[model samples]
Target: MRKYLILGILLLGSMFSYANVSIRSMETELVAVGISHESIKEAENILNIALKKHRIMLIELEQKELEVNKLLIEDPEKNWFQINRLLDEIGQINANIKKNQLKAQIDVRKFISKDDFLKAIELHQMNLGVIK
Candidate 1:
C-alpha cells in the first residue's frame, strides 16, 4: 500500500531528525563547559563510550518523540496525551545528558588542578610576580 509506505517513511525521517537534534544539543552543552583542550578530548572519549552503551536507549527515546509528534499532528484533540508522552521522553533524555555532563565535569576538574600545578611551577622557575 502506498499510504503505508509513505507513513513508514515519514516515521523513520522523524525519528532520525529527533535523534540528530538530541545528539547536537548534548554536544553543545558539553562544549559550553569551558574545559581545556586535553580535558575536552578526554571528556569526549568518555562520552563516546557511554553513548555507545546507551545507543539503543537514545534511539528508543527518539522514536517515542517521533510518535508523540505524529499523534499531535493527526488530531488537535489528542494534544494533551501527546504532550505528556513527549515530556516524559524529554525528561529521560535530559537525565541521561546530565549524567554524562557530570561525569565529564569531574574529568575536567581533575585536569584543572594538574594544569594549575604546572603553571605554579613555571611561575616559580621564572621568579615572576610575588610567590604566595
Candidate 2:
C-alpha cells in the first residue's frame, strides 16, 4: 500500500510537472518550429483547459490521500471500508487525469503537426530537467 502511494505520487508529480512546463514554453517553442499563430493559440487553449482540470484533480487527489492516511493512522482494521472507498476515488481521479491528458493531446494534434507537437513535448521534457 505504501509503495503504491509513493508510486502514485511520483507519477502525478511527473505528469503535472510536464504539463506545467508545456504550458509555460509551448508558444515560444511552437513559434520557433514555425507553427502558425492560430495553431499555437488553439494548442495553448487546449492545454490551458486541460491544465485547469488537472490542477483541480490534483488538489482533490491530495485531499483523498490525506483522508486515507488519516484513516490508516487512526485504525486500519476499522477503517477498511472507508479506506477502500477512498482508494477507489483515487483510482477514478487517476483515470480522469489520464483521460484529460489524452483529450488535450488529441485536441492539440488537430491544429499542430506531429513534428511540431513532438518538438514542443521534447522541449518541455528538457525544461523538466532532462539531461539534454
Candidate 3:
C-alpha cells in the first residue's frame, strides 16, 4: 500500500513538473529571443485581442495534455503510438507561439525607440507639473 501511494505521488508530481517545465522552456526561449516583458504585454494587448487570448491558448494546451492522459488510460495499446505525435504537435505550437511572441516584442520595441521612451517620460513629468 505504501509503495502504491508513493508511486501515485510520483506520477502526480511528474505531471505537474512536465507542464511547468514546458512553460518555463517556452518563456526562456522567448527571453532568449530578446523579448521584453513590456513588449510581450503590448503585443498580447494589441497584436492579439488581449491577454485573454494567450490565457486561452495555454488552457487549450493544458486540455490537450489532459486528453493525452485520458487516452493513455483508456486504451494504452492504441493511444500509446499517438502520444508522441500529439506531444510533437503541441511542442510545435509552443515553438510557434514563442516565435510569434518574439516577433511581436521586436515590433513593439521598434515602435518605441529609446528616444521615444525618454520623451514619453519627459512628457509625463511635464503633465504632472514636475517640469516646465
TM-score of each: 0.41, 0.71, 0.47
The local distance difference test score of each candidate is 0.53, 0.79, 0.53
lDDT of 2 at 64: 95
Global fold similarity of model 1 (TM-score): 0.41
Please give the lDDT score for candidate 2.
Answer: 0.79
Considering summed lDDT, which 10 consecutive residues are worst modelled in model 2? 16-25
Q: Pick the candidate with the highest TM-score.
A: 2
Error (Å) of candidate 1 at residue 94 is: 1.8
lDDT of 1 by residue, 35-74 (tens): 3556545545654555453555457656776776677788
Better of 2 and 3 by lDDT: 2
- Could you give candidate 2's per-residue lDDT for residues 1-132 as a string of tens digits? 767865875686577567556645677767777788887777677877787887788789889989998999999999999999999999999899888888887887888878877887787567677747
Q: Which candidate is the best by lDDT?
A: 2
Clash count, predicted structure 3: 0
The CA root-mean-square deviation of candidate 2, after full C-alpha superposition on the true structure, stands at: 4.4
- Residue by residue across 16-69, what tens digits does model 3's lDDT show? 344334323344334444556565455334444323344555566566677777
Please say which candidate is ahead in TM-score: 1 or 3: 3
Candidate 3, which segments miss by more than 4 Å at Cα? 1-52, 114-132
